[model samples]
Target: MPEALAILQKYWQHDTFRSLQKEIIDSVLSGHDTFALMPTGGGKSICFQVPALMNEGICLVVSPLVALMKDQVANLQNRGIKGIALTGGIKQDEIIDLLDNCQYGNYKFLYVSPERLQSDWILDRIKNLSINLITIDEAHCVSQWGHDFRPAYLKISELKKHFPKIPFLALTATATPRVKEDIITELGMHNPVQFEKSFARKNIAYMVFEVEDKLFKIEQILKKNPQPSIIYVRNRKSCLEISSQLQTLGFKATFYHGGLTSREKDKNMQLWMEEKAQVIVATNAFGMGIDKPNVKTVIHIQLPENIENYYQEAGRSGRNGEKAFAVLLTSPSDSIQAESQFINVLPDKAFLMSMYNKLCNYLQIAYGEGINEEFTFNLNHFCHKYGFPTLKTYNAIQFLDGQGIITFLKEFSEKITLQFLIPSKEVIRYTSLNPNDEEIILTILRTYPGIYEIQAAFNLPLIAKKSHHSEAEILAVLHKLNEKGIIDYHSKNNDAVLIFNEIREDERTINKVSKHLIRQNELKKEQLQSVLNYVAEKNTCKSKMILNYFGEKATTNCGICSYCITQAKPKKDFSTLSNKIMALLQNEDLSSREIQNKTKNTADDVIFVLQQLLEDNFLIIQNNNKYTLKT
Candidate 1:
């Protein structure tokens, strides 16, 4: 066996590489600048990881997300491979120690965020390491045309000067042709070997439905599938509400969103992964490093912000090669809502400049000063003080962060402490009276060994998992316990930390990236338009549409998509069908099903003709909820 194959088997325990994996690995191993455009679940990691292992020194991986870096590092550690992640919040001394370890401790992988590359000291340290390969994950971020463009990703090209001979491997799950060209050019790849696997999931049946009641449609889909599924919503509120609605309707469901505590997110994710929950309703934040091969359906309850996001989220299903569904549920109002949610909120160059000036003032940073200064930022307080709209202000700040003018660290700490005020006997009596809260209280008592003696910090989500409850339920019980003097519970949420990367040259800073800002807004508009078109276009195959968007010219339509399924049915003479329905309705009122039975036409065709008749004022629905001829 090849050395790369041996390494893959030893580490990943896979007997063979997925399509394009081996070839990409070979290209990288042969010291070529390689670009691998594999779709999600295509094992893009292995293309770099396996070959990196076969080399003599460590691999340096530059990624866009700190969470992704941490996940990859954890996975490497789990396989007995030494890896280190230089994520945010690490002090310079700790970074020195970690770099030292990477230099001498036989570390095989060093994962760092693209922002970390901007530090000269860190780059100097990295220069001394025995790096064999340079891998850029989410490489599309380097391109302004990409959906998730980050200016910090451009700094990755500077590493080429340091390791001029090392092979550079760029990997991304989704990138348009424009973004693809930008990635290669920005990375300064020399005669790069590009491998693009078709962005088509043959096993997934893309489905779209326009419905009056989304929840009812969701229920019907879940009932018919009865398998592990994901329902994607746009916000945390929807995540909670939809998941709760599903649970009330007798489905095992859980909710996840960015607002969730890390422990809560873990517990909820565990429930879904373990199959204890049949459905997980979440926002776009849920599926970064998750790979569950058995997700039978991915239903989007709202229009996604763009096609790239929707493609990645929807592609999460059908990974096990069985037939799965990617369903989008929309309403007449969703298009307007989507426009308001995505387009209207886009911060233009003017808004970005104004917000940047305001941010400088809010932070009290003087001109040409406050570089490298970090402050605790309360977004709501800042927005209220300036009388700026919250969402747009947030987007402006995010744009600033993306442009590398600032570093916004949104992950803050939540401190929760607990101590039992009542004696053990009293607690037992209280639990006996409130049996519903018994499991939670008992789990807390068992998990925190010193809760009775002193105030202890407990994992809220762990208790919820052990008690088979949710974090909200656990918090409610804790608050109740505190109210009754059974326990002393205190929870404190901290504000986010913002680090100013550049000095306060407010207008100049915005001006330097003005073109990028304008281009980014345009790109967002185009992407959102693509999504709207995808949802609105009913004549084309959904799979072919997605494939075409990703720059692949699909020659054949996928027969399993909603459009293909509808088109495959024999075309009905709708006028003839309508006449028959009208004649039947002339005699007596009949329900749609009864009409189908009498006419011997498919329910869908019958419903279509009935709708046409009703729209033309040739029919009406009586109080008995049956079709009837107008008197």
Candidate 2:
């Protein structure tokens, strides 16, 4: 076996490489700068991982998300391959220890966020490590034209100055032609070898439907497919409501959203992964770094903000090379709603300046004195106090974070600690009286061995699972204990944290990056328009449209899409369609849906014929909104 194949079999337990995997690996092994443009499920990680394993020293990976970094590190460690991630919320001393492990403890991978590279201390430490290769995940972020542009990514090329001889590998799931050019130029790749897998999934059918009742359509689709599936919603409320509704309708369903505690998210995800639940309703936070091969369908009930996000989400299905469906359900009001949610909330230069000033005031930071200061931020309370709109303010903060003016970490959970105040015998007696709390109290005591001697933080979800209770119930018991002076409990909830990277110059800070901000807003508008056009388009094949958007020209129509199916049917003359519609109404008054069902014609053709009939005075609508022959 090839050395790469041997490494893959040992670590990943796979025999063969997917399409373009071997070629990309070979390019990297040959010591050339490589760029791999694979789709969401194309096994991009293996392209760099296998070759790095074959090399002598550790591979340094720079990624954008903390969760993604931690997940990759955990997976590597599970395979008995040592790895470390320098993610957010780590203290200086802990970072030193992790970096030491990377340098001397025989670690194979070191994953860090792009922002971490800016620290001189970290760069100096990294300079001393025996680096073999540098991998940049989500490489499109280096491009300003990319859907998710980050200024931190632009600084990644600085690593070349330190590791000039080490080969660089850049990987991304989706990128446009412009973004591709930008990545190459910005990273300063030295004559890189580029490998791009076609963005078309032949096994997955892309279907779009315009319907009046989205829930009814969703039910019909789920009932027909009846396999493991995912339904993507736009908010936490929708995740809960849809999952509950599906459960009530006799389907094993669960939900996930950003608001869910870590334990809740893990429990719900486990149910879906183990196939105990038939469907998972979730917001966009659910699918990153997740690969489930048997997913037969992925349904989006609303229009996605952009085609890049939509394609990546829809591409999550049919990974097993089996027939699957990517269904998009849109109502008449969806276009307006999508525009309001995505486009209108984009922050312009004026809004950014105002938001920055308001944020400093909210955090009580004085001008030119608040550099390097961090504070807990509650977005809802801040917005309420200042009478500012929530969504726009959130977008402005995100823009500032991307610009490197500040660091905004959302959904930041604070530490929860507890310690026993009474003696062990007294606690046992109290628990015996409250038998309901006995299991949880004992489980916590067992899990944290030092709880009796000192305050210790515990995993609420793990205790809930061990004691057979919900997190809320566990919290209630703890509260009761604390109120009775049996234990000292402390907990805090901060929605986000803001770290000011620069001193407060307010308007001057905004002025430095105003041009880039305006350009980014324009890019967002253009991306939104592309999604709208994709939804409104009916003549072209959906798969071909996506390919064309990504700079690939696909000539053949995918026969499985809704547009192709409609085109493949035998075309009926206008008179034939009109006659069929008229015949359906002659039996009794019928709605458009009934006419389309009886006539077995496409909805567009039926609607066109119905309009002609109505205009010709051959059909009349009654008070019930049903059509009939003119009297």
Per TM-score, the best of the predicted structures is: 2
| Worst window of 10 by summed lDDT in candidate 2 | 209-218
Model 1: C-alpha RMSD to truth?
A: 5.1
Q: How badly does each model clash, as a count of residue pairs?
A: 0, 0
lDDT of 1 by residue, 1-631 (tens): 3488789889889899899998998898889999989989999898888888898899999987878888889999899999999876677799999999999899999999888889899999999999999999999999988998998898899999999999999999999999999999999999999999989899999999875558877888999999999999989889989999999999999999877767689999999999999999999889988999999999998999888889899999989999999999986689999989888988888888888888888888999997778887888899899888888888888888887788887765677998998789998999899999998888888888788899898777678778899888989998988988888889877557788877988778888988887888898889889999999997899999999999899999999998999898887668888889888877888987788789998655776787788889998877665888887
lDDT of 2 at 511: 94
- List runs of model 2 lying over 4 Å from the truth: 412-470, 478-491, 572-631
Q: Per-residue lDDT for 525-549 in model 2, tens only?
A: 9998998898889899999999999
lDDT for model 1: 0.89
Which residue pairs clash in candidate 1? Answer: none
What are the models' TM-scores?
0.85, 0.89
Clashing residue pairs in candidate 2, if any?
A: none
Q: Cα deviation in Å at residue 285, candidate 1?
A: 0.4
Worst 10 residues of 1 by lDDT: 602-611
